[model samples]
Target: MNFFTIKTSWSNAEFILIKLCMASAYILIGSCFHDFFENHYSVLIGVFIITAIWFVYQWLKKMKSHSDIPY
Candidate 1:
């Protein structure tokens, strides 16, 4: 691993898992407002869980690889 080049000690499976996590984070963040638009408490809560799960799954993927969820 270097500034110009990248290398990961994690297995391919781990990398995929991390990417999935990051993606989910984004989805949750998007869904967060769905409740407001439709007025569904379940949607709001569901989004919250997704957001939280994605927040933690962030560690699954390499931070430097990509910002799966926008800052």
Candidate 2:
């Protein structure tokens, strides 16, 4: 109801949206690389590293969300 409360709720919503975007991005990127790496194991390893980095970033962002913020 107050300004800070409203701001926090909005920020939480944004965080959720960002998490979704990250997940979709990883899925799409990984699948594309997987398909393209059929004959190249080295490329597949690179893709895995990139995807792992993305996952870590997303996890950190999600952890930043305030649990007290009202959805």
Per-residue CA lDDT of candidate 2, range 1-71, in tens? Answer: 34355333335644554565566556656766676534555554555566666656765565467555556
Q: What is the lDDT of candidate 2?
A: 0.56
Highest TM-score among the candidates is held by which one?
A: 2
Q: In order, what lDDT does every prediction score?
A: 0.55, 0.56
Angstrom error of the Cα, residue 57, model 1: value is 10
TM-score of each: 0.35, 0.38
- Model 1 residue runs over 4 Å out of place are 1-8, 35-71
Residue 67's lDDT in candidate 1: 38
* Per-residue lDDT of 68 in model 2: 55
Q: Write the per-residue lDDT of candidate 1 for residues 1-71, one digit (tens) a residue.
A: 24455433566765564465565556556756665444554554565566556545654455546534443
Candidate 2 clashes: the total is 0
